[model samples]
Target: MDEHTPLLYPSPESPAEDTNAQCTGVSGVYHRIGLRLVGSLIVDSIPVTLSYILQNSTQTVSILVTGRLGPEELSAAAFSMMLAFVTGWCIALGGGSALDTLGSQSFTGGNRPTDLSIHFQRCVILLWLLFIPVAILWAFIEPVLLAIGEPARLCKDVQAIMRILIFGAPGYIAFESLKKYLQCQGIMRASTIVLILVSPINLVLNIFFVHYTPLGMLGCPVALSITYWLCFILLILVTLLSPTHKANATWGGLQLQAAMNLKSCFGFLKLALPGILMVGTEWAAFEIVALAAGKLGELSLAAQSVIMTTDQIIATIPFSFGVVASTRVGNLLGARSAIGARNAAHASALTSVLVGSAIMTAMLAARNDFGYMFSDDEDVVRLVSQVMPLLASFQIADGLANACGGTLRGQGRQHLGAIFNIIAYYVLALPIGITLAFSTRMHLGLKGLWIGKSICFGSVRRLTHMILGQVIGLFTVGTAEYIVVWLGTNWDKEVEKSVVRNAEEAKRRTLLEQHE
Candidate 1:
């Protein structure tokens, strides 16, 4: 294969490129680009969405089973699992993205087909080693939570749940590495296939362990651990035994060269650290908002909780679509097709925007009834409906930011993503949101915080630039903040009192639970 060699799937009508070679005039170019974008996104999205749905379903089953045990079990497991996700899975997702650069490039650029296999093992080893500290955190999570003033009973129960889930840490992390390995090979459907097979099995296991077995509440995590291992093992088997994998020769027995090189070790850390921080900063910030929402009145806080829960479900699409972008761009870059890589990145961005649009449309249609799924409180329902437009706006930014971040990861430029996140969220969104949340002069309540967040991404900038034929200008600051400040002028002092009330209630609950 030489520089002039055409893409393997080159368009029949064009010898130059596979994706965008059919254009003649400006209209033709845009038409071809549109077709290519939609084609590739459809190809990538289905498998990714299927896999995530199954995985989330697994979590749902565990929660539902534990919910039957008791409220304490349900809440404890949820809290512990959320923390574990932050500590373990976020790192795994970010860290595994290194392979988005390494494995993809090696697949097309290396002399040996086995390089991807070696790199996969290296990632597995590196991630497992990284999991050590996270595992330690899980072991002593009670003290850490206590030190941070978490409710005493919640702390104790979460610690126990985490200990059970800890058994799955290596498997979960290593499975992430395995998923990347297959993805780099353009084997997008494998994990989806494997998870679909395993998801039902996991539900049965959950029922047996959490409900039928004497393990009860603890059994929920145990079942999850087992499910994680199953996913890992089955993916490995797919790599080894699948007819598609037979041609790759990707699985040469593991090598220790990665372990032997300090440069390589440090290289992995350098790429992975920024990636982790990029994801960690935003997620950690969102966690803070969850904390602050309680400072609003009870009705506001309840509405916030239900809305956030629903948002989590819708959130999966953009993030998963971003994964599709990362994988697609990485593969094209690895093949050294700059044009193809650019096209893939642009297409992915478009796909995210489209997906976000779909979400917004769905939210608009569902707003009246969505809150009723969680609570019957009219205040909560009304507040949630009021915030739907803001939520819809943020969903767009979440999609675009995540998609762009994925592209950066594919290029091995995870640092850029960290910078984007730090500047966009930490330096801007968080402070803006906090100020709006606590603003007595602007009694915007929960809507203020969300408005502050959405404005950071500047939908006005995106729309203005789009209308002006300069999409690049979306990166600039927009007039949304001015709009937010002007609209937020009703001064409500009771929000501050709610903060004090919430703090007192938390302490009382903790003390009372301790006595129980």
Candidate 2:
């Protein structure tokens, strides 16, 4: 398709053509399609957003509960959780994203009904295996922390927290994997329902264990472990007991033979490895900024922590948009409706921009007071207020990146998305951020760190463009470039690839069954 092609042109087979025919004008037809897709995306995105919000809240509550003990204890809990996110949680989310591509497509591909379940099973097993090393690392993290020159006391505390948290890692990984299993089948609310029921229980457990019980600071991890396992179990029960059996068609009981097939494993990894890097690189970049914040002293660290926490929560909005986009696009591609997939992709990007702008406005409005929710210290609070504008400006670019990234995932181009992230954050964003953050002449401190990040987000205006010039020009361009690339996509080509992918899976299943 070329730039002159209409954004919502109905393919000859599309039912949308009937609706388009009834419209008074071509513009009217496009308008209706835009509204329909945006509305559907919003409806699907809400539950996903809530699920993420509730999921993050469980960990945030743990830190809040432990914060009452002492600063040192709170810091250790936060630090340990950060480590958990970077290692175990990142592996779960990043690796599980493979299913965002495979599971969603398989569910709608029609060629093999069991492909979704088979992919899910393989993902869970692979992620569990991946976590083994992380578990081992957590078990011995104290020495590693000390070797890196962390205070001996803080290292011990972090070690204690991580060791207990380790037992719960598999449950968290499995739960994330299962959520994808259900979501790809259009069961968007199951995980949300599970989290809604479990989040309050998690809060009560944290309060009781940390305060009413004898465990004290250690109780935080105990509660977290129990909560993670409870979420996993509840999700399973929901799947099995749903009146509709929303997942039943795609989930053919455990297929250990197919799941463990050598070629199947390699095929899954082809999509999964880049997915890990696509997500992990961005997460690691932020973690690096957090570490750098520590060097600016306690106040900067505290402010950075609060901003990062708030950003994570806010990030769910765009992330949910991406999730829904990935699923919707995959489903359309699977059904061989290229027009529908392309329209959905464009709608998601447009909706994200609208949602992101609203978020930016809210953040800007609350800039001065938002910091108070996380800290009472005047210095940290002030520093946070000063940094809020940069953070606020980032929401739009962040949303665009996520929406476009989702489209790429749907297209099975995660490797391309991974390349963008590596280039955007590491090669472009970080070096600039770190230099300004640490440079003696600049003395930008926390603000410098965020300035570099804001640039990476490509939110800076002409002033920044003029100041930074070509050295930062590429970094300032942002994820909008992805949208341009997406516009050029051969949607029909993508549909063919999905068909081939499903055909391959069907052939593999046939071979595996014959061998058995």
Candidate 3:
């Protein structure tokens, strides 16, 4: 069928009458839908969460294995991984997010199923093209670090590791893109399976390369590179050989034309650029906090490391929730079910709050002892105990923001989320944090940094009021604003937009196909 042909499903302008019928019993229907959506989101999020935890462990394992080499080796591996997280990993996450919008929509949009494949191809091509400069930068990073007045020996070590890791950058980005491809098709467990199969191998490889093979400190990256490529290959095999063929139905093979489609490439970037900003801005802000923590003295820095590491692990839950929300909302939109999309968004927000609160309670209960998990230093443990409450307080806000951000992504409104992050973190939270952290009078120290972040994450109460007085917390403000916006959204309009978006893509594909 030509692209101009009508979708097999009801058009947005003429939604199925049953949707209207359900709206008549709005309260009961919505309650049922919310429960069902929450259950589905949780079920979907578990595998995704496990996948992230496993994937993250690979890098952490590398650090653990290599850190035993010496302090300098440990420092180099840690620094190199941080740089990789900000640059290549962020690009993979943010760049691949475009597929979260387009691919999910396409899969349910009733266009040719291959449109999902086309979007995946476009994402892979763009991200790889983007990685070229990153690789080049890694090759020359030592000079940049030196220019910044970093220790020369440390810079040299970091540069060496980065250069080795560069070989695997494409594999990392491609694997992320492929995960999105499969995820959009409802194949959520594939990546988890791949990681389950690869994690042990990764650990073995790290040991073999670093100790047995004589590669020394550099061996960690080599093992990592091999592990990344293996993950990508295994995922590809899973897609090809799966009994269900959910992913296979969408895979149209490696079409050179799809990758080379200029219009499609630009379309992907439209969402991707904002997605990059959404991820990078928040991540960079945390990194900035980490750098500032280092300036506070070794004790404070160590405490900050403990807190940050725990936060990253805790964050995977909301992050997974966001992922599931994005896919569900996008699928509902593509299917022209405005009510379903709206319910899913609400359910996602509710789920995040409930989950975040539970996490916060647990963290609070463990605050006194949590630091012992990372370090035995009394000073560091004491400082971490002091700061844990502030961190715990904002979990709900973080969860809400993530859920809302995911909803925005599914609705093709990533730019709005990016804007909120920039304003909240950069303009509001960071400035307030740095000021309080270093202020001669306040003397809040590590607490000040977290307080600033907590404000951005949504802590609003007597403490915040006492600190800032009339000023509202950014996290509270941003998440509230996001909820308001979502409440005000016209899901019918969103459905229309999704339909129009898919139709335009189909038209473009048709023209390209005809020309070919």
Candidate 4:
């Protein structure tokens, strides 16, 4: 059998084993495993998180700049963003996760290096196809929102915002696919590097397009579209020109064959649909909360926005860690190193706790001043302060849920994560949150919503462990290979060393791509 194929073909189903015992038997070199795992995650996650944070910040900067023009401009931009988030953007986040599975595994699996290239092609085609419906849906958003009883003015403005925004859809999803494709291969720094460089350009473009050009409100989407496409283009250039990519020679020039495999396209869908739901359901639930907050009154909605925005930024830490965990597990599994995959998951959980505690502390420290960053109103600031404690608690719980979610993705069990999220947020948190948020006696508003979410997070954390245990079952894992993906990741020269070693061990690598 091809050595890399073991991950695809597991040992026969067996009797259940103690989860604690299985985790303990991870290895005698647990200390080294922990260090390596932490190092790998830090390597992959830091820059990735930074890049995404900056990217989100750049968009925020654009909005802030627009807010200066008038409240109407700001409202339209924010509403446009909300609609984009639920539709095209959700597809990007979740659908790109498919690469977290297939791309990572294909690199270490017994496939030609070109397999990664083909997989990249397949993802681009698949995501673009999925985005078509979304683009068409954008065309009709005005009437839809109006029919649903959104204010006619708000719907009219939002419609104008989306019209121009839909053109950017291709660039957005394409960037995500490429980002995941390269991330799985260890070129982690390129994203941050590109975003940092282009984000300023986006800011400048927004200014010029809005005032200096004829686009007016349409400039917002147009400038952003340009930014997204540039980010995508820059990444492709960086990957092709980088020495590490040349060393691997993973990209054969793109060809018709890259998009020809309809069968594999279906496989991508199988993995992607669950990832889509996982990210989509979470985002949707939050949007619902935003709408609920809106119903409570303008103050409540503004306060929720302030709190949620900060939380979203802080969220990058755990979300990035989960990305690290997913990539690590997928890489190890592909190399048939079950021990390594198991160790990666357990070590990541510990790392998340440590990180979560720190984030919780930071949130508490900033509670008094956090709202002022977004608003000057004393009521909004005071309201945000009341909820900061709950928000802090939610961070820790969020850490656990996201950690488990990432591991589940690595295991190619995203459907489980999706199911858990649906139950946690939709079935559990949303109902309770709405009840508390709207009750005349309770009228908890934003605090109630956050509190309910905390409960949901607890449930998600517990269920993650149970689900992980079930999927992993029993296996004798060994530290035979220590993989470090995301090539430009700042994690020592280990990845560089791996490349030199891999070149020398080409035959064996073709069979397993094992790391020493």
TM-score of each: 0.82, 0.90, 0.92, 0.83
For model 2, the superposed segments whose C-alpha errors exceed 4 Å read 1-13, 17-32, 212-214, 244-248, 375-379, 458-479
lDDT of 2 by residue, 258-278 (tens): 887788788778888898888
lDDT of 1 by residue, 1-516 (tens): 211223222222344665354544434434545665656665667777777777777777888888888889888877776787678887888888888776766666554677677668878888888888988989889989999888899999888889988898788888878888887776777888889889888888988988898988888889899999999999988777766667777777756653334555676678888878877777777777777788887887788878777777777777777787776666556555554555566566667667776887788888887788888888788889888767775665567766766666666778877776677667766776778778888767897777655655654335344223212333232223212322331112222222332234334434544776
The most accurate candidate by TM-score is: 3
C-alpha local distance difference test of each model: 0.69, 0.81, 0.82, 0.71
Model 4 misplaced regions, further than 4 Å: 1-32, 460-516
- For candidate 1, the clash count comes to 0
TM-score of 4: 0.83
Q: Whose TM-score is higher: candidate 1's or candidate 4's?
A: 4
Better of 2 and 3 by TM-score: 3
Candidate 1 pairs with clashing backbones: none
1 versus 4: better lDDT goes to = 4
Across 1-516, the per-residue lDDT of candidate 3 in tens digits comes to: 211223222233544446544564336544545454566677788999999999999999999999989999998998899899987898999888888899888888947888888898889889999889989999989999999888999999999999999999989999999999887776788899999999999999999999888799999999999999999999999888765455237777788785677887888899998998889888889888998999998988999999888988989999998898888788789988786777777778878878988998899899999889988888888899999988887777788888887888888888987887787778777888899999999878988898777766542333355256322344455356555656668889999989998998888878878998
Whose TM-score is higher: candidate 2's or candidate 4's? 2
**Cα deviation in Å at residue 487, candidate 3?**
3.8
Q: lDDT at 258 for candidate 3?
A: 58
Candidate 1 lDDT score at position 67: 83
Supply the global lDDT for candidate 3.
0.82
CA RMSD (A), model 4: 9.5
On residues 1-516, what C-alpha lDDT tens digit does candidate 4 reach at each position? 111212211121212212322444335425435464566566667887898798788668767766667888888888888788887798988988878877776677534777777778888888888888888889879889988898888888888878888878898888888888877776777788889889889999999988787877778888888888999999889887777678767786774444444556776798888888888888888888877888878898889888778878988998998887877766666565554566676667667767877887887898898899889999999999888877786565566667667767766667877887798788777888888787999877787787665655645334333223321110000010011112112222323322332343334334343432
